[model samples]
Each structure stands twice: as structure tokens, then as C-alpha cells.
Target: MTPLGPLLLLGFISGHLTLTRSAKILTVVLVGGSHYLLFDEISHILHESGHNVSMLVQLGNPRIKGVNYTGRNNSYRVISWSANEEYISSFNSWFLEQQKSFFEGSESLSTFLKFMGHLALQCELILGDTSLMDSLTAEQFDIVLIDAFNPCSFLVAEKLRARFLAVHVSNFWSWYLAGLPSPISYVPAARSMLSDRMGFWERLKNSAMFLGSWLTERMLYSQFDHTIRKCFPPGSQPVLSELYLKAELSIYNTDFTLDFPRPLLPNVVYVGGLLSKPARPLPQDLEDIILTAGDEGFIVVTFGSMLASVNLPVVLEQINAAFSQLPQLVIWRHLHTHWPSGVLPAQNVKLVDWLPQNDLLGHPKTRLLVTHGGLNSLMEAVYHGVPVIGIPLFGDQFDNMVRAEAKGFGLTVQVNQLQALGNAMATVIEDKRYKASALTLSHIHRSHPFPPRQRLVQWVDHIVQHGGRHLRPFGLDQPWYQQYLLDIILFSLAIVSLAVYIVTHLLKFAVGYLCSGGKLKVA
Candidate 1:
């Protein structure tokens, strides 16, 4: 509506400022192996959206050029993290607490504090090594989104006064996030009790857990906050502190298709199926074998990427005994040596170091799935509507297997119990309910509220493009003392008020007594 010359100039300037600005540098801080699943999807999204992406993974894998390093395997990574004596000692103490944890519901206050202490220490060291320090020193990033487990990366963002978002690689409430979820339950990655959704009893248990867990984390943050302040001078500089104070957004790497009846946050975007997308093409030989299997039907056996290569000879024997009997040919993803030389490669069985998991699952003739119940594998099964026989080893596998079993799409049998393994597999393969249930679940999985990868990319790009002001965690901006809701302060005030009232009454009584010549009672 302005004058012609001025309006034209203003529009041109606006377009030039926005459209011609240099691309922003987005620094992504990934904390674990699973974090790859989340960032992998977001990476393509960000690049296409016109931002430069640099990744800082604590345990980097070479597959991603941005990742700085990779572990030889899970054991090697575990060893690397354990190299620190205090961390090793503390981890050992918490690691063995699994039995006690099962009885107590989830991690208790001491257990959680111990776990957090180890994680914070490990993250700090790992972050420094991953070139995250370089990004911070350069102050090059417009936004830093950290997978939440690595609180140290958050510390780094806070150091640089950059806007940050917390990325959760696992299920919601499965890891500790400050403020949200209420009362602060100790929901470790593998909570022994419920998923993010809580029932009446679960709510009660979590309420207690929240109180205890809150105290422990409070103590943990106290130590870490000091280190954070030291890391960035004038973290005291209110301007910088204000900018870095909160997480811009939280992204949940889950497809609503797979996770149901699970409570989630409005801010949380489920991008779970991101990992299920096509990556490298399946080898030709592998493709042929899978296509042939699809013709008559076959069962796929996988123990997930981490645990499959697990050197548990006993578990292998148990699985072998059961798979050898199915009507369908077995496609086994074996890690250690070729299916135990001469165990008789039955015409109905095929052995390989790996299989094109998604392709195979998507193939029509795939009949059954025998898994270790890792979340990624479990979700894949749901997406494909394949019946599952779960042999849970540890972590959330047990809970996942239990849920799958309860859902009627699968059955759970402990790896140690070979008989249970055989029986459960027989039931799922033969029973109609499991198959029907699997199909129904597949329908739900496919019918999720949105396209997972697209949503993930959308939200991720939103943060980078908008400069992160929209996604920051507003809760922590308030003081910790306020968050804790310190009743002690209230009690102290009440006591002072009561004391003044009593003292005033007593002085009046004394004055009246002296005037009337009555003695006061003294104890």
C-alpha cells in the first residue's frame, strides 16, 4: 500500500534477505547407535531444505560420513565406555541391579542417580572427542539438536548459547526428560513396568518413583550445572544463557502405527518408521532367495543388529532346535560361523550372515518372524503384519515381547527355555489368532496419523528454518527451586508465623500476670 518506488524496493529487499541468505549450518549431536535411525531420516530432510548438516555422534559409525568414529561392535563400545574406572565401577553396580530393579518396578533413586552420573560423565568425555567442541568453539551452528541421553551435548549447546532440541531415539517416557511427564518418574530406556502410558496402579507406582527419581536427578543437575557454567563464561551472561536455556523441540523416533494406547506429548512428533525406509538394495543373490521364499512362504529369524552377533552359544542352540522343525523353510541370520557345520542344512532351511530384513518382511510369502524383540525389529514386524516368536534376552525386549504377546500378534518365550521357544513358535505358526492379529496390527501401523519420515523431516527442518525459538523447552527457564516445589520453605514460614502469634500472646499474659500478681508456669 506504500508508494510505488518504496514498495518495490522494500519487496526486493525482503526477497533478497530471505531467499539469498547463506545456508545455515545445523549441528546434530547424536549420542548412541540407535540415534542413527532418527538422524538418518532427518539428514535427507535438512539437506533438501537448504541447510548444511554436521553430525557429532558419541559412538560414531562410519556409514555416515559426518559421524566421527565407529565401534568395532557393541562389546567394543561397551569396553570403550567402561575404560574409565569410576564409570566402570558405577556401571557394574547398576548393571547388576537388574534383578532388584525388576522387584522394585524400575530404577530406584540411588540406581537412577548412579546411572545418570555415569551417563553424564561418559557423555562429557565422548562429546569432547566427537568434534562437538569444535562446533561450539567456532559457534558455527544455528541449531543443535541432541539425542537426549547425551546430556553433555546439551551442555555444549548451552555453552555456545545455541538453540537446541532434544531428540529421543527410543519410546517416550522410556528415558528421563526434565519437567514433562509430571512428577518425574525414573522411566529408564527399558522401564520394567509400563510404557509411556500409565494405568491406575502404574500411576501410583510412578508417582512414588517420580518423587524419588526427582531428588536423584536434582542432585545430578546440581553437579552438572556448575560444570556447564564453567564451560561457558557468563553462562552468567544472561543473554547467552537465555538463548541456550531450553530444548526447542522433542522428536520421538516412533511411528504411531507401531506404538498405540501409548500416551505422548503434543510437542512430540512420531517419526518411528524412518528406519524402515529402503536403504541399500538387497544383493541380487539375496533378492532371488527372498523372492523364492516368498513363493512358498518362509520364516525369517533375526536377533537384531546388536544382540544377534551376541556370542551366546546356549541361546543359539535353543533357536536352532526350534527353527529346524517348521513347515516353512527357515532363513536364519547367523553371526558366528555357518549354522554350526553339518547340523544338517535341511531343504527347508537357509543360513546367511544377514538378510534384507525389510524386503523379506514385505515379501508376501514370509510366514513367521522369530526375533529378539528389539524395538526396530518389532515395529518392522507390525508394519509387515508378520507373526512373531519373541526370545527376549534383556532390556526392553522383555517388555516389548510381553506387549506383543498380549496384543495376540506374537508369543514370548525366554531364550533360556528351549522348550518354551519350540512350543511358542509352534503356536504362532499354526494358530490363526496370531496371524489375524498381526494383520490387524499391520493395518493400524499403516494407518498411523502421519507419514513418519516426512513428519520427522518437517519438524527437523522447521527448527532449523525458524531459528529454534518455537521449540525451546519453556519449563526449565524457571528456577530449579521453583520446579522442586519446596514445601520446606512454606513450613518454615508457617512456623515463624505461629511463633510470633504465640510470643505476642505470652507477653500479654505475662504483663497481665505481673499486674495481677499471678506467677507464670515454667517448665
Candidate 2:
């Protein structure tokens, strides 16, 4: 055959072949964890959607260390770094110190900053690791999901050249960092114990606390910036303010029902119970205990993971004392296997190192929960329609309990008040309104337009498609003074000053003219 005939046959053979392309699956990297529960839930959801998700967590995190990560099909890969365990221990120790240590240290501001500094220091364990950073950069993640708690994650994301950044504040009321309105006139600080409704004097105190905390935190961020530059080889130093401003999406672990009505940016989403899942079947022994309680019901007590370090033997004693008189069986999730000689458990009280809290709260026999008012525990109680006796120690716990009280579903006792525990527990148990209110809130929470997980995923996808740049308000771009319109105030003051000066000068001139023209013509 001729050469032209052979070429035509080869073209016909090539036309029979088909070409195919698959959709690009986004790669998401989650860095930073002291609050792994929130991150874990989000990572799994993203992974299930066929996206590649990896988490770089601190080995020092007790929650992350305890969880089992090995399995078939595997939810997500967890990469961890072992920093100094002492850093974690010291941070925990600070929480357990007398509450006075927080308010009366060298300077309460400095003390608070130091605690934050310790957390920032932990980030160095990941940021300074050249090998890990190289591997992460090679993976070329599409986005970086960071716990708002660790501001240093900003550096990691920048170094990896990630396309987008999303921050999840595992707790509520993210201070001024989120660029959302948190008016001191009504909205309380994250750590504050004040309620949204306050008297004039109380509002003044709140304002002072707010201003002081905001200023101090700004100073703290400077220190964090220094650490970020020192730990990482720095060409481009990202200021903390820039990170907050550039954040494509920010999620707070707070619901409007629990939080005060404050103006929020479109970028901010409240997903309070995102970590919550349907209660799993309880252990056989624990199930037996609940079943035995019958109509009398049982009380669940837990101060969360930090309780093991809390030195408040007095608080434990009061809790025990109160349970002794109640008809309800008490299930106290005490971390220690043995109680001190001075600490005695009531006959009706069972002390276990851990409890399936969600399952326990959902049980028919769980009448009341005596909690430290941690957001996680409070949301669980609200989710299950259980009343609470809140003894908040610090951080957002106090504000959480205050919200519960305002909603009529719970009451708070002073952390150290031995006498008030009995009354608090009695009120929660005897009052029917508490249970009714809790049920109402539970219904409202369940009936929200979007479940927490769905809201989270929707926002993540929204940011991926839209880049979320429009969600950032113009207010964030303005300078601090301009954002508050201080210039307008200054201009108004200048105009008033000029008007007053002109009036005074005109009066002087009129008097001078009359005197000069011999107004003594009356003679």
C-alpha cells in the first residue's frame, strides 16, 4: 500500500481511543489542636466527602493522644509532634492553681499573657520542623483549617502556600480577634462571668475589663509574632491582625440561643454542638446502674478533662455532701481511682474515672447534671433536655452557666461555696420549669435550619468556591481610629472650638466699638 494509505489507517485507529479526566479533589490540612474534638469532627466530615484531610496535632494534647486512629479505610491521617510534655503539664498546672493566681499574679495581664505565650511556644514544635514542613508543602493542600486558639497556624499556612485559610474558635466569644462586634455595654467577654443584661456600674466594670483585655491581648499577639519569626525562617512575617482580617471563614462554637445577641460578620458561623453525635449504647455495667435508678433518676457530675488537675478538694466535698441528701443516684466522673481520706462519696454516689457523658445525659433516668459549665458539657445537657447545677470555675464556663440560668434551665453555685451546693441542686431538681425549659431549648436546637455539621461543611464549600473575600466587611479594612469614626468626632470638636472663638471675638469687638465711640453721650 502507499504511505498515505498507511497514515489514514493509523489516524482511524487513534480515533477509537477515549480520554477521561476525574474531578479535582481538594486537599485540606488541619493544624493545631488543643481542642481536638472540634477539629476531629470537621476533618472526618471533610474526608467522608472524598477530600484528602490530614491533621498535624501536638502529642502533648491529652485528648488527641487517647483517641484510637488506626482502622480500615481510615477516617483521616494524624501526624503528631512530641514537644516538651512539661509545657502541656505546666499549662494544665496553671489552670489548677488557686483562682486567685489569675487575678493577683505579678500582673494579671502579664500572667494571662504568659499562659497564652506557653500555648504559642508549643506551636514551635510544628513550625520549626523542617522535615514536616517540607512534606506538608509538597502535599500542596488546597486549604488550611486552624484552631483559632493557636495564632501561629497562620505562619504554617503561609509557609505551605495554601490557597485559603479557615479558623474554628473551639470556644465562644473570640474576643476582638474575629473582627465582630462585641459591645461591652451588653456582650460579655469570653472569660467573663457577667451576664449580657447589666446595671450601669456593672456595665462600667465590664467595659474596663473589656478594654483592658483587648489591649493586653493585642500586646500578647506581638509576643506571638516574635515567636513565629524566631521559630520559622522568616521572609514574610504575617502579623496576627492580618491573619484575622484575611481569614476566609471563622466558626465559633456558640449558638445564638446560648450567646447574647451581638452583631456578627457574614464570615462568622456559630456551630455550637458540632462535636455532638447520637448517644452510643452505654457499657453494660453503666447501663445496669442507670436502669437500677428507675424513677428516682441519677445525677451526672463532671468538670471535664481539666478536673483531674483541679485542686479544689473543697468543691468535691461539697458536691459529695449535697449528693448524700438527694434521692437521686450520683454518677461523678472523677478521674482519680481513689479519693482522698477527707473526701468521702455518698452511698448513692458512684465515682468512675470516666463516663459516657452524652449517653448518660440522654438516659431516661438522668434527671440532672452538675457540671463545671464547660460549653461542651452544657450543649450536651441542652441537647438532651437535662437540667444542670453549674459550678463554673474559669474561662467561658461562668458565662455558659449564666446563659443557662438566664434561660431558666439551670442555676450556678459559687465554685467554693459549700453551703450553696445543696440549695442549687435542690432548686434544679424540685423545679419543673428547669426541665421544661431545657426540653424547649433542645427542640429549638434540633430544629435549627442547618445542623452544626452541615453548616460547617456548607461554609467550607462556600469558601472553596467563592474564596469568601466578599464576606470580609469593609470595617475590617479600615484603620482602628477610622473604623470607630474618631476623626469625625475630632472634626466636630474643632468646628465647635472655632465657633466659640468667633463668638467671643465678636462680642469683644462690639464692646470695644461702643467704648471707643463715646457711649458716655448719656452725659
Candidate 3:
């Protein structure tokens, strides 16, 4: 062949390889709101990378109804299974009650357990739909990425016979699932509300919290056993805990700069700020408000999407009163229709049904953030160098706020202490140190050798291209007893006990012989 012919052949072979390299990826989205949005961002990233991505969406939460879970202009395929209206209503009722209980400080362990039961029932609904499962299986996906909150996703991945990775919407729980070492000495347990710097009593409490979390997870997983058996053949049912360990990768939506230092395995990746990007221009109305604020700038207040429908009249009154005391314009994310009957927002406070949170946070005129301490919000605040006043409600919110406070960029007040909200906001805004610390963190988060999105995409590509088995530690396959070296400890204890017994008897014989004047005594 001529030189030009060889070049043409090489180009054709390269194109063929590129076409063959694209993998078919399936993302399981079980919950709605921010959880759904996180998965959507992941699917979009993969789709942009030339992978054929499909999303399996289960509309389990009625609160997220009518919103486009997927972006308006997207190329990825979506397969959705929405629950019946009756189920949706029941879920919505339970969710509102749960929110009320949390705000009232009346939520208990039993309530959380009931929520787990709801998850199991949702899983049953998903698996019982034979046509949906058949359609998913027909796709023959190369890999599955699941939201780690629901154990049912593990079962779904099992049913599809695909290797899977877990995407934890927060920084904590997935550590346990990945079997990552979490020494209670420094790494605080999930939702324990303790920071890495723990005193003696705090350490004890942290350890207890770890035990409680482990028990809670076991109880949570046990609720799904019946569903597993009902859905799978007798011998083929997947063990929920085992499925957790089988994950090829555990991707946490947290960054080390924002999270406390902790040990992580090779398969664990932190992609905290994947959703963060450069700020876009705000709408004209919002821009006008920003311009009117002048030297004071504005404060952004949002309690996250889950709490959008929940109205706490007492808390609302306190917050409204607090916002009235501030000089800065308060851009609060609360439905005007759901505003408490008698509580009136101050003239400086702007109440809107919806606001572009990221854009507002990134705006130069934005001074402070009043948040529910969700990880996503915290990450965005850190990304934009904005200080925060966290009013943590539930789940990992408390812990996320603790991390922010520990990092010196924020302070937290309980829901009951809503009166302190204004003071905390004032402190964060007036204290130059808080702003300096936040800017430092933002720089560190942005200055990492690789950005979060790139890390997520590269690690995922690596796992899909070469498989993640080699990256997994051998200890994950070992039994719990072996993992803790319990057998070795037992053997060592036995040997010591036997030696002690022999030495004691010999000492007795020697003493008896000496007391008997060297005479032997017959038994």
C-alpha cells in the first residue's frame, strides 16, 4: 500500500476503536428532589462523554411531582415508573408528619424505622413490575450506578446481573457500605453531631453512635429480606450487606476540604462539587434586587427542597422576625402561599417560590447564606466562598453543619433556637475571619490537581474500562471475625491461659516440696 493508504487505514482503525469504547451505562434513581438531581448530573456527564446512558427513575416521592427531574434539553433516555396516586398521597402524608416531628424535636427511632419500612414497600412495587424489569434487563447495561440510600438498588443491580457502583448523596453512610476504615478516635460517626476533635466523653459518645448506626443499618437491611425472597429465586437472593461490599466503587458527594480528614479505600472517590459551576447571570428582577441592596449586599436563605412544603409557623415567625432585624436584603426560598397566616416578612425580605440557588450563591452581591446545612448547599457555599449560618433539621444536616463550624466558615443553631438565627448570620457576615476561612477553603477545593467532575468521570471510566476488582482491598472479602483479628486474639489468649496454668501448678509443687522438707507425698 502507498503511504497515504496506510494513514487512511490507521485513521479508520482509530475511529472503530473509539466507537467500541463507548459503554452502555444505567443509572438507578429511586428518590426525587436533590437525590434525583445528583443522579441526573451523573447521567448527563456520562452521556456527554459519549457513553449511551439511560436513567431508571422510580417516582416514589410525591413532593417532587411535576418538576422535570431531567433537564429540559437532554439527550439521555429516561425510563420512569411512577407510583399510583394512592401510594403518592400516603407517602406525602407520612413525609409531612415526619417533617413536623423533626421541627418539633419529637422524631424518634421508631419513626425512622417506619420510614425504612416505606422504602422496602417501594422496592417491592418496583420489583413487582415484571415488564419494567424485563425492559431494564433487555438493555444489557455494562455497569449500574445507584443511589446508595435505598438498598433495593443493590437488588436491582443484582437482578440485572451487572457490576455496580454507589453514589452517596452525602459524605457519611457510604463509608460503612464501602467497608472503609473509620476509627472512632477521630472520624466521628454519621449524624453523631461530633466533630473530629473529640474529648474523652465526646469520643465515648461517638463510639456509641457508631454502634447505634451499625445496628440501625442492620435493622434497615433486615426489612428488605422478605422483599428479596419474594422477588428472587430461593438460592439466588442477594444479601444486602454483601451487595454493599460488592460495589465496584463508592462515590461520595463530599470533598476533603469541606469534610474532616478520614481514611478511604482505593475504590472510594470524593466528587463533592460536581454540581458546582461558574455563576450565570441572574434574572432581571433578581438583578434589580441585587443592585438596590447597594453596599449591604444580600443574604440567601433556603431550607432545601425537602422542607419547601413543610410550614413551621413558630419557626417561620422567628425567622421572619430575625430577617426583619438585618440591614441586608434577604432572598428567602419559601412559597408565598405557604407563608404563615400572621407572620409577615420584613420589607427587605424577598419571598419567592423558587430561586436559582447556585446563581445567587455565586453572585458577587451575595454576602451570606442561611441554609438547612445540606451537603449540596454547603459544597456550593464553599465553592463560591460564601459564609453560612446552618439551621440543621435532620439526616446529615447536623453533621454537615458541624463540619462547617469546625472549619471556621459557619455556625449552627437548633430549630428551637430560631431566635439566634439573626445573631449567627450577623456574626458570619461581619467577621472577616469567616470570610477569609471560606475563601481559603474555596481556593483549596478549586485548586485540587483534578476537579471533582473530572475525578468522577475518570474514575468511572477506569472502572468500566479495566474493571474495579483490582482496586478492591482483600479485607472486604474476609469475614467480620477475621477482619477484626478475633481468631488470632482468641488463640493468643488460649496460649497465655495454658502457660499460666502450667506455671501455677509447678509453683505449687515446688512450694509443697519445700514445706515437706524435700519429701515426696503420695496421692
Candidate 4:
């Protein structure tokens, strides 16, 4: 009871903010592939506000060859960290090999371990180098913007003595693992393919998956903590959970308009399209092709960076077949070097190694997007009012596509069900409701009082100016068993058991006394 009193008081008052002036920001983006877009935009925003901004990033990772920065602002200086190219290539190979296993639910425990180990090693490479760590520590950043996916970055924040910490998460479900309320009754796990509205059986499955996912996250955190501890002096480093719980705010690449309505903490901000910009005019070749398609607009297809390694000939044939049946011109962003010899592309179809995804989605002639349901692509689609045919391959993609379908903005078909893709495409194209719903959501997405970038900057500045010490939930201080009131449950059970035992014994004594009295009367 005494412990709870302080917790309640602290939590009640923690929501209050102590506003201060702006701050010098340091952005740490460890996932340096396509994910760099998130940080680049953030750094640009901070830089625009006359704040001193510096970045620590891995230059080894690139989503598209020859194009490293989508909108790299020259104002912010970058500290590049390089890794062995061969090693990075091998790591990507391992990731590619596991995609099928991940989708099939057959991914081995070793695969998961190796992946985390790889991230840990990447951290080691940076933190292990004395000169780099020293340089970073000397920066004395006011605030550190870190990717939530890379828990190891917390050690850097600690070393730099950063005043405040904010996290950017590419996938939203991971936030649930950070001690937020995500009821299994309705909230779907990141990998879950189920919609928010579920039947009894589906609810049961969601609960089971929730428990499993939580356990897996705990294990991963343990690994990260163990690795991070080694980098710091003994007894000084905090565990991964502490770092997450201490975060003042989190910027999720998700919005309520595209997602099912659910409870969220005030500290959790949705700046889903912070990286999005006004669409640029299409490249001349693409413009020419798009213009030639008279009344029937064009379709854009892309599967994102990780899945770009797909070289399945049968899948290519299926895609080609579907495209041939449609009258609309198609711009397929295929990644493999050689086109499959088995199928001839339709006259209306064009293949490219890469495409400006956001720009294409924004084009007026583009009516539909065939995507893998990655969050970035979905956000872009929603921003542009473009409907989607999501063929989720793995990970949070399945969940993202499901939400899209539930929201009436898109439809989803299994990647293997290539035959049905054409029908799914036809249904979405012929149905005006999909486009109308997408446009509605786009309006909602854009209707925030403050633009996403401004909102992000303001929140970050708030945390920096005010220590944000109060934002920590009181539940974090309580023990997990106590937080769930398991102790109270046990105490109540004991009380009930004692009452039943006393009542039964008293009845037995009364019965025994009656028997004795009867015996005495008979005598």
C-alpha cells in the first residue's frame, strides 16, 4: 500500500511538461538502408530550426545503387561508419534465405539468434573502435534520436550524456513490447494476418500469439542487454528495458487514420509520413509512358528492398499473366538482373530495376499500387490517395495489409495465389469505393492541426527543454507480478480457503458432539 501511494502521485503529475527553448540534436540512425529516409527528414527538420544537428550512420547499407540519399540535407554533417562490404553482403544473403522460412512459420531459432547477433556485431564494430566512441562521446549531444529497432544505440546515448532521448520505429507493433497497453483481444501482433475485428477463435489465436511475441521480444532484449553491458564499465550499464522505458517519446511510422482505433500513450506520436514530400514530376521516359495510356491509368508495382531479391520464375510468369489481362500500363520495379525467359511481358508492361516510389504514387495517372505492404509504401499510398493490392511476403507486412483491407482502402491476396491476383486487381480497379475510402483516409492523414514534421520537432524540443523526467509510467516501477495484481489474487484465494476450512471444521465438531450426546443418552 505504501509503495502504491508514491507511484500514483508520480504518475498523476508526470503528464505535466516544463517547456523550454529549442536544443542541439544528434540523430543516430544505425539502420542505414531505406530506413535512412526517416532520420534524414528528422535531421533536416531540426537543422531548419537553426539547431545544431549531427548524424552517426552506417554508409555500407544502400537500398538502391548509386542513390544513397533521397533528400540528404547539406546543413547536417554526417559521421560515416563503414563495415566490411563482404560481411554486409553475406548478412543480406542470410536475410534473403530466411524470408521464405519466415513466411512459412518455419524460421529456426538459430536464424533469429543469428540476425540479432548480426546487429550486435554491427554495434560492436562501431563501439569497439576507440577513436569513434571517443569522438561521439565528446559531441555532448542535447538529445539523441535513435532507431527503436537497434537497442544497442542506447549505450551511445548514455555515453554522450544526452539530455533527452526519442525513438523512431519503422514498425508499430514493436511498441507493444515496450510496456504499452496492447490487448490481445483486439490488437494484432506485427506478424499477425488477422484484422482488428475478430471472432472468438481469432481472439484466442491473437492472445496466444501475443504471449508468444512478448516472450520472443524479452529474449531479444536479453541478448541486446548482454551485448551492450559488455561495452560499458561493469555495474554502470542499464538493461535494454530500462532504456526503452526511459524514452521520453516515440515516433511511430503509423497513423490512426490508417490503423484501427486503439489506446496510445501521449508520448507515442504518429508521424507516419514525416519522410513524405510533395510529388515531383515523373522522369521523362516514365512521363511519356504514363501519357500514352489514354483513359486507363497506370499501375505501380514494387516489393520493397528486402524482398527485391526474389527471382522466382514461376512468380514472374504469374505476374506477367496478370498484367497481360489488364488494359492499364504497368511499371514493374523488378530487382533481379536477368528477366525470366519463360514469359513475355505485355506491351503495356515496363520493367525497371528501381523507381522513385513516392513520386510514382503521387502521379495523377497512377491509379493502383501493387505492393508488399511495407509501412513506408503503405504510408506513401495513403498520402497519395492510391489504392493497393498488397501481397504481403513476411513480417509486419501481413498485418499492415490486413489493416488496409479492413479500412476499405485496399485488398490483400496471398503471394502464392498468383492466379487470384488478377481478379483482386480487377475488383479494386472496378470498385470506386476503394479509391473513395483511400481519399477519405488521405484527408484524415493530412488534417492534423500541425504537419508531421512540425509536430515531431515540437515534441522533441519539448522533451529537450523539459527533462521529460515525468513521462515515465508508474507501472514501470512496479514489479511485473505486482503490476498484474497476482499478489492480490493469491491473497484473496488464501483468505477464501481459510474461511472454507474453518467452516468445515466447525460443522464437523458440531456433528461429533451430537454423536457423543446420543451415545451418552443411550448409556
Which candidate has the highest TM-score of all?
Answer: 3
- The lDDT values for all models are 0.60, 0.71, 0.87, 0.77
- Cα error of candidate 1 at position 414, Å: 2.8
TM-scores for all predictions:
0.68, 0.85, 0.95, 0.88
Off-target runs (Cα >4 Å) in candidate 3 are: 1-20, 60-72
Best by lDDT: 3
Backbone clash count, each prediction separately: 8, 0, 0, 0
Q: What tens digits encode model 3's per-residue C-alpha lDDT throughout 1-523?
A: 8979989999999966754478899999887777877888899888888889999888658424223232626667888888798988888788888987787767677887788888888899899999999988998998999989888888889988889999899877557898999999999998888889999999999999899999888887788988998999998888888899899999999999899999899989889998788899998988998898999999999888777666788878788889899899999987777778788788999988788888899999889999989898999999999999998887788889999999999999998888788888889899899999999999999999999888888888889888899989999999999999999999999999999999999999999999999999988
- Candidate 4 to native Cα RMSD, angstroms: 7.2
Worst 10 residues of 2 by lDDT: 18-27
**Which pairs of residues collide in candidate 2?**
none
Cα lDDT of model 1 by residue, 262-314, tens digit: 44444555666665643356568876776665455788887665333333334
Ranking by lDDT: 3, 4, 2, 1
Model 1 residue runs over 4 Å out of place are: 1-32, 58-132, 175-178, 182-190, 195-245, 260-266, 278-282, 291-296, 336-347, 467-523
Give me candidate 3's TM-score against the actual structure: 0.95
Judging by TM-score, tell me the better candidate of 1 and 2. Answer: 2
Worst 10 residues of 3 by lDDT: 63-72
